[model samples]
Target: MNSHPLFSLVAGLLSTLLMVSCAGSKSYPPLATVPEVNVQRYAGHWYEQFRLPNSFQKDGASAEAQYTLLPDQSLRVVNTETRADGRQKTATGRATAVSGSSNARLRVKFEGLASLAPAAEEGNYWILQLAPDYSAALVGTPDRNYLWLLSRQANLPDSTRQKYADEARRLGFNTTRLLYRPR
Candidate 1:
């Protein structure tokens, strides 16, 4: 079979892309969060600053989340995302602190369609970094597969964004792939 030069070039490019995507950050110890978190202070609306690409939030634009402190000390999470066409999607869930956790780690269960009860699949949401005034935060999962940068304001300064990304990189996360959502 005759192999075309263009075909060979395309194959090489694809292989490189695969390798880059598969190779994550270097080995590191478990991810850690702030020593203490005041859940009440952290409860409020936070705009999506930057995030690692994930299928769950693919094609989402103008994403934001609002947290409310429940009476029972749990949290009510409301996430909203608008599409380019102005269509909006929302997911509401409840978050509870992990036992012995200082309100930094939480388990959230969102309500799925057609289910009166909470979804069985609970995801780990950890607050890796937080501003003293609760103005900004860096949230991620245990394995570092998912990450989100949140801010109280919709428009975050470029310098602050870079600072957060650098912090994520220091925490053993691959921030090169972080995507900024529409304002």
Candidate 2:
């Protein structure tokens, strides 16, 4: 039995593991001039144009997320989706804007159901980009794991979509990970 072959196999395995680990690591570019996003102007109904798939939301379906300012400096998030079976599902969560910096950063927790334990780390949700007219928004997490393209109405114009995609790319988000939901 030659020891050289065994050593080469071990080296290859280690290199593969290292590469995989590095590829899986998460990093996000610094916020690009945190915009002065008015929470009041942002509050209302937004339709999901694209999103990273979550177990809660199904594919090829229309969904709406309603945001309302709560009394305690937090947001009331109500997400409703029309499923393929023609049934509707809704999830409610609370989002608290991180203090300072014009409320561009927020923490969202969906552990409202009594049966589930609260999340250990409040999910970092950031509004990366927003149309000056408040017609569209690009949102993502600090770790760059979750990103969503949302519009004020059920459909967004092609120009708006392209603009958001370019902005997301500029912000170093993985545009390939963006999953467009059917209108």
Residues 1-183 of candidate 1 have per-residue lDDT tens digits of 686888677767865875587567466788888887888998999999999988767545778999999998889999998778888889998888876778888888788852343221223788999999899999998778789999999989999999999999999888989989775
lDDT of each: 0.83, 0.74
What would the TM-score be for candidate 1 when compared with the true structure? 0.80
Instruction: Score every model by TM-score.
Output: 0.80, 0.76
1-183 per-residue lDDT for model 2 (tens digits): 354776667767865875676576665545653566778888899998888766666766678899998878688988898877789988888887776657788877774462242221323678888878988888886555578888988878777787888888777777876667665
Which residue pairs overlap in candidate 2's backbone?
none
Q: Tell me the RMSD of model 1 versus the true structure.
A: 11.2
In terms of lDDT, the poorest run of 10 residues in model 1 is 114-123
